[model samples]
Target: MTRPNRPVSTVRLAGRPTQRSALRRATQIAMALSGFLLWVAWHRGLMRCDTHRAADRFAEVLQRLGTTFVKLGQHLSLRADILAPDAQEALASLQANVAPFPPEQAVQEVEAALGRPWQQVFARFDMHALAAASIAQIHRAALPDGTEVVVKIRRPGAAEQAETDMRILRRIVLVMQGLVPSLRRWGLAAIVDEVAANFRYEMDLSREAASVRRFADAWRGSADIVIPDVVDGLCTPTVMVQQFSHGAHLHGLPSSTAVAAAGKLVDSYVAQIFRDGFFHGDPHPGNVFVMDDGRICLHDFGIVGRVDGNMRRALVAFALAFVEQDAEWVVDAWLDLGLLGDGTDRAVFVPVVRALVADCAQRPLKDWSLSGALAQLVAAGRTQEVRLPRDLLVLTRTLLLLEGTVRLLAPEFSIIEAISRHTTTGVFDEPKSAASQRLPYELGNAAHALPSLLARRLHSVLRQGDLLQLSIKPDARMLSGIDRLGRRVALALVTLGLYIASSLLMQHGVGPRWGDMPVLALLGYALAIRFTFSIARSRG
Candidate 1:
């Protein structure tokens, strides 16, 4: 699934900012943000846009400002909890509805990117962009051979504008750090970093071209899925040419063939993740189209995901464990994926996951989803101050969107049933119960009897001089414990030393008095206070 970027007319890569220009831009950003915040407070409540009018107002301003501001709005639209539904809707419109650049400028961009005249490269090219977005615009064009294709041109100055905007954002984050004091810990900084990466990635058309070819290869010879063929000869760092594919949005409404279409999409995505290990990161309806021939057309390869063998296996184990209601296995799989943070309590985490899975599994497959379950797991992990890998967050969001998209199209679709399509594909060995796989299998009665006989003989044969070797890597929990203990011990030793020095100085009266106290004693007490304060700060 793919969501288009913010709409823009022109995006030239900008030049370095002079001090005066930087100051002017900084002033503009401050004034705009302050006005927006003040307007929000008057029109809505704190931290949320409660009414449609407020949502519309905030959205209108961001859209008018354009570029990075609009991009930020697009991201905010996904945060339903912080914004009211109407607000989310209002911001989402910016994704595809922002103002388009002049048609002549779009043509110039294409010509410059290709390093050739427009007529030479395209037999017939549409002057008007098919679509305009924050980073780039798409135009319908035909190659010299008359093959139908879509050309994506990077918006002039888009890169420079984004860079300038991110610098301003970091300044805002720094300001927040002083006020809220835990904004970084809240992961807002991480979110901004991802946004920066996301925008940069989308701007690189050559990267997107490569991903298109990769997806095409992954589904080579497949009839159920369509990946547009990239015209690499015409592709450039700022421009991409690829085959055009069409399909219905197929969201919130599904035709009679929807069940089959939804099933195929789900099956293909599961393979992309668990089997092929490369997937589309954003799977919204806008990124996917249903061909008239019942084949699904996947689009927007700017943000594809790749999973190595170990991660793929771990994800499979996690999904199966969830379906099987195996809490321990779920914890283990999360541990394998590095989703759980340090000091995660297995006892508490196991029960929480089991309860959540049990409640979710109570619903029929048609009404069930892993999204809520995953959200709960993530929230629980956060309580322990566990730091999860950022990539896991992206993957979870992608899968959650995919699940919703599939269900929206076909309400009765079953993900499990769809996964069976590749049961024979050998992405995984035949699945078995975790318990059975973890333990040696029981064979015959002779095998069962041999274990007890061997135990008695081994005990008898064990002697004082017998050699037994065992080696195990250190546990994470053990290491964390040692680290904390070391810090505390160091603090305690320093505190004791300070106390002794202060007592000795007081007894001996070693230096000039400060009121009734010796200078040496006063210095020792001051050092102790500083040390104690440092220790407290570290713990906090």
Candidate 2:
């Protein structure tokens, strides 16, 4: 029920609305945002003045405002780059749980989505909600065939309200960006837009059905874990139905069961992150339930996170660096991950990073200065005015959650130990040579070679001036390659020139006319289009 993500939606209003519709949306947004602000003001006296308290306050406000804002809060929880840790931590409550909407409205939503009365759709449809949440409510029911299922019904008017709220937030964020320049650096507008996309995805329940189906396909025949199967011919934009897991909730599971469950959860995440490069975005205890037979059931697909191949490699590098206690390796991993920019002050940054690695290495998992190594690294980056990417931040938050839950169930378990065992394996494909492992230390120990290396490099630099190198374009052996490149360049230039000439000829009707346009120009246009696609196909 807490599936929400990305903040980019603030600026992304749905539809090319008429002026009246725009005005109506604007008014709705204004009223909604204002009410949220009022709630914040009222709660401030009992809250801390820092960003953490502010975040908790914001979530409270969103819950009060209803589904759209609550959904927004859930997305905000993942945007660690945009918000401080305290704020992110506070927003996580949205993912943990949301207040239930009334049961009668849930029935209406089901009826509206299915285009029939609940009685017709199911042999026994439960009017009472099994669990109620911001976006949707879950209810236990059975088909005429006696197949048990849970129907997820979106809150009525969620889409319309989310769009309005997103639009209003966009306008407000833009205004704030202009008025308070610091806000622009945080990419608040982009964050809001992402949240809008998340809301939009969740608002369309069919997408969730597809996501679960794909997840199931990915893990086919895996007996250790379970992803609920979607009900065929039973999904709409506002509602979806999936086969329910007859399992104990995570809260009710014994600690002994939890220990085993935690290990399964970690292994599942490893498969999702390392093998497939796609994963369930939020793997907190709330989204997990343990069956009596001990199989783990994962719920919610609207907020899955994806890391492409390159990012997965970077994560592997980071994990390896931590295992080796190579501070420089971790720093390099951060740079490769785009969490630290080229312009960052590495001289000042290195010591701060080394200290962080040292501190985490020396401390207990529960006593780490920040949530975990990743969070502390991000925190250090924040201190040095560096910005981490949103994807890595989400991964960090995810790993931290996993670590906490694992510890609760099995205090003796260590994800770090698991990571060290896997880092040297082919699972992640990272360079595992001793040279790669001790690269920074090798450089550090080779201080005597620095002067000779610099002298040789400087001599080479003096020998090959930039202008001198450019003057010698194509060497004799490379002439064929150069010729091929030249042909591509010539083709591109010719296509552009022909395109311009055709447009001019058609505009002035300068050549033989066909349908009041120049036939020669038409021919030229056709030639340009053909060549353009030819070039694209060749590249592809």
- Runs in model 2 deviating more than 4 A are 1-64, 94-108, 115-120, 251-256, 340-342, 364-371, 383-387, 430-540
- Candidate 1 lDDT at 415 equals 77
Give the alpha-carbon lDDT of every model.
0.74, 0.73
Where does candidate 2 have its weakest 10-residue lDDT segment?
6-15
* lDDT per residue (tens digit) for residues 1-540 in model 2: 332342322222233455687677567666766676666666665563433355555666565555566677767776655568777766766532455666777787788888898899898887778986656779999998999999998766557767876887899889868977987767779878877987888778898898899888887778788888998889988789999886776665677787788778878888788877778877776787787778888888877767876788888887777767688987787667776444675555577668877777777643442236666566566655676666676677777777776766667776766655665566777435577769878877788788998898778878876524545567776997667678788899999999999999988889688887789999999999998997787661
Best by TM-score: 1
TM-score of candidate 2 relative to the true fold: 0.68
* Count of backbone clashes, every candidate in sequence: 14, 17
Name the top lDDT candidate: 1
lDDT of 1 at 95: 39
Model 1: per-residue Cα lDDT over 1-540, one tens digit each:
222343442333344666787778777877776787688776577556554466666666676565687887776655432344456667866733445667788788788888889999999898777887767889998888879999988877777777787788778777877777755666667667767877787778898899999899888789899899898688887889999777777864446768878888888888788867789888887887888888988888876777766677788888777767688898788768765345667675787787877776677765656656666666667566665554566576677778877877787787765654455677566335566755665545558799999887678557543437455788999898789879977987998899899999999998899898899898888898888888777772
lDDT of 1 at 97: 44
